[model samples]
Target: MFAKSTNEKPESIKRVEKVTGRLVIFYEVDICNKSELHKIFKLHKIDCVIHLAAFKYVGESVKTPLAYYVNNISTSLVLLEVMQECRVKKLIFSSSSNVYGNPKFLPVTEDHCTGQNCTNPYGRSKYFVEEILKDVCTSDPDWRVILLRYFAPSGAHRSGLIGEDPLSEHLNLIPCIAQVAAGQRTKIKIFGQDYNTRDGTCIRDYTHVTDIADGHVKALKKISEDLFKGWTAYNLAAGKGYTVLEIIKIFEKVAKRNIKYELFDRRTVGRSWQDDDLKTVKTTKVVGKRYIVLHAGNKNGFIPGADLVFSSSTKNSDYHGEMNQAAKLQNVQTLLEAHFGKEWAQHDNLEWYKNILKGLKDSENENSQDQEYEEEECNSLEDEIAIHI
Candidate 1:
């Protein structure tokens, strides 16, 4: 159990508070300690646990293999044991793409071999924990474990308030890009360029961290079901790969400025060993019929009609039922048709309308405090109308 640090904002706390509809509590405890973990769990009704704590540095794990093992594997073992003891069966684990080692195929499936060529202890630790969970499920029928292997995470919570603030001074590419955009860094670094890729650089799939968080919530929704009662795993990825240079270009476009960078000659460790061969795995898609339908709608230039209606309502309505005189519903309809396509017209759902109504109602509630409401602007939340509404 971890509490908010000085780096976390009041908005992050408020966001969690609003969603859960309760006063969020904070706890400080080492999960590695069995008694402490059990004590905390016993104290509260933990309907779900999303484990996001782990030593993540690939290079550092190579140098400090023992430390990595002790931190990653040992802590996980302790937590699992405590969960078992406390009868808290639902667990959503944070796994990694590094566990895949060098992928055998273009798009690595869940069945793809893992722990084969994991270059470092950090990956191996995750792999070991996964195996542990698999065994735990095999031995016990009550436990529910969902191991979600994550790709690279990009972007903040959209409020710009809560972003990845790692303890280490060394930054990941997206955060580094953000820093460069903010004028904190003079330039970015292209780690390796001469590798065998479309652009002669290592390619990776980057998923938004908030998307990953939402995935945990999604998994939690299924944990109470029979299908996901035992051990199950899913890859939480963006289903597309972007080269370093391409990402930098996107950042440049987004920030409306050129980003400076140079190629370095460090030994490539993860996917490829040499500068000549840049290995990459194509990202995985959401393997569901509904997802297939949505994909078709997306390609055909149609979104769920609810998205259009809700988007129109948000911009046109003045807080309540009152409409904005300057805002034209037809313009909003045109914008939605252009942006979401004909799919919005095809689909029939009022869920998006319901959510907008909920937000509006919540915004109007007499009990809701002005201080309790925090400004949150999330582009991802735009798609919130997709399936729900």
Candidate 2:
């Protein structure tokens, strides 16, 4: 399939490389350009194409509806035209759960009505594109397409090497959580906690990225078979839903620390980017995998390589042990250690300081005091105590 941008193609290439030992060729040509697409199709012996290139920002789609429609809808038309000309009749198109919109019923079935609840241009784009593909496949019997509708994809490959890496700002919840845990972000923001779901938070089915990738392979296999003909749609979810609160709890458990989060009542820039479908993976169960665990002590959070390197450098210093311990305390501790060192651990009255910290910890545990601690309190403490240490 043709990618819209050059930067995005490298990731697609790497993912495709893992499955096939044979040299897999990837070209960076905008699918919106028909002439470029036609030339590429003529060059490759592509039996069937899996079209995944699309502009998928829901909020941005709302602001620039035309770009969303043109990029998502128009690009598909161009790809189909090229395929038709090249005599490639089979295609596996990437669809989304957003087309279903706000679920009329919990655990939405494929037969459940579509296009009615789509809240934004992005959802509408997917809905309209699916309709276009349906018409294209129906009008011509020679055309066979499989529409794979995906849910929230998270968790990199077990190796943690290859996965979704948007070059700019992140828009997905998984990456956002990762950033917070890695300490890149100060706090995790839970957009809505008042949704009519358990825990009052928006719930979503988070499928592992590798599992979703394997679904692509399964669809490709179906296309290779003579029995798999005509157009069909399938929902690729984990067959479950997870509330935002539960996800935070899991991440905190995995990272071995508390994750600070707050409920956002007004900041509803985007509603839950999540979905469930009744069309289960009965025909094509992804082998050797079934469920994803938000495991404890996984130590995965917003920590980037730079932070790791900085922390490691402190560890190698003569005072490494104390620095490492300080870094592990929290984001505040890491900042303190990096700036002030062990002196921050000192106090005019060591016993008084320890007692105060202990009391604060106790009050927080008892949930009696609702006072929020300022980052500045611990921010410069290290520097202040440097002479004492």
Candidate 3:
């Protein structure tokens, strides 16, 4: 498979090579460099392209709007020009639900209006690209494109060899929570807790990364079919929504640990990034077997890897601890001793322990509350989540 490596230290790509024992032909060139990207396309005799390069962080995008526009939009424009020149018209563009902005309705569909109310430049970039692709398709019937608007994609590959390993501070919810559970961070900073949702936290639909990958394969297959002529869009999501606090409780269950968190006044950019009206979606029909299933009570509807133990020898192993024993009581004493230098017993009754216990109790009460209306709304979109190109 052809890919692009932008990071100087592309450790994940190297790990892919090591584990699979297969050569991945990739170029480290920037996608905005049309000549270089064109050469790669011509050299490979490329027939199709999957455009996923973009500056995606919402807060970062708000901080630097020009960078987001230049990188995200420029790369797509360059890639499209090269594709047209190479006569490689088949393309799958990774779009985002952010293009929908604050949802006017629950269970958003492909027909949901875009390019309006986009709260940040990142969302605007995706919307602009989609519009550009639409114009390209209109100008040439030979060009076919698929826009995959993804919700929150989380979790690791089932093999556990690859996962979300961000170089900078964690921006997504799942990774941030995992960092706390793994002791990499002392606590998770919840952006807001005063929204209008049932739990007063922003609700989002999260799908497994594997499922998101599967959606791409299905999109490619759909575009290759002769009947699939014009450009279309689909939402890749679990069709269920979860509050930040709910996810934390679920992660605690899966990780067998207490996740400490503190709430702060939400930033405008932060709210734009995640907080919104219930943002579940009824996905378009992709030509493939359904890969997503939602079990009762599990909002994410997938197995999470928070408790996964990694060997220290693995190149990507950032956090190491005993398997299935990460939060055992004995380990707590060990952790205290390590921190307090053998005088931990004297501070065993410290207020910190009481606060943690209190947090756990508060979390339990929050999770136990039922949002029947929201659950029903999400269930209404379950059957539609089945992908059929």
The top-ranked prediction according to lDDT is: 3
What does candidate 2's lDDT look like per residue over 33-104, in tens digits? 899888888887878888887887665677788988888888888888888989998988888888887665
Q: Which model, 2 or 3, shows the larger TM-score?
A: 3
**Candidate 2 ranges beyond 4 A from true positions:** 6-22, 266-389
Q: Against the true structure, candidate 1 has what lDDT?
A: 0.66
* C-alpha RMSD in Å of predicted model 2 compared with the true structure: 20.1
Q: Each model's TM-score?
A: 0.65, 0.66, 0.67
Clashes of each: 8, 11, 5
Q: How do all the candidates rank in terms of TM-score, highest first?
A: 3, 2, 1
For residues 160-191, could you state the per-residue lDDT of candidate 1 as single tens digits?
Answer: 65667555655678887877778888987777
Candidate 3: misplaced stretches above 4 Å?
Answer: 1-9, 17-22, 269-389
CA lDDT of each candidate? 0.66, 0.65, 0.70
Q: After superposition, how far is residue 307 of candidate 1 from its true place, in Å?
A: 69
* Candidate 3 lDDT score relative to the true structure: 0.70
* Tens-place lDDT digits, model 3, residues 268-381: 433322334435422211222223222221223322321222333323222111111224323444444454455334222222223333444423434323334334545554
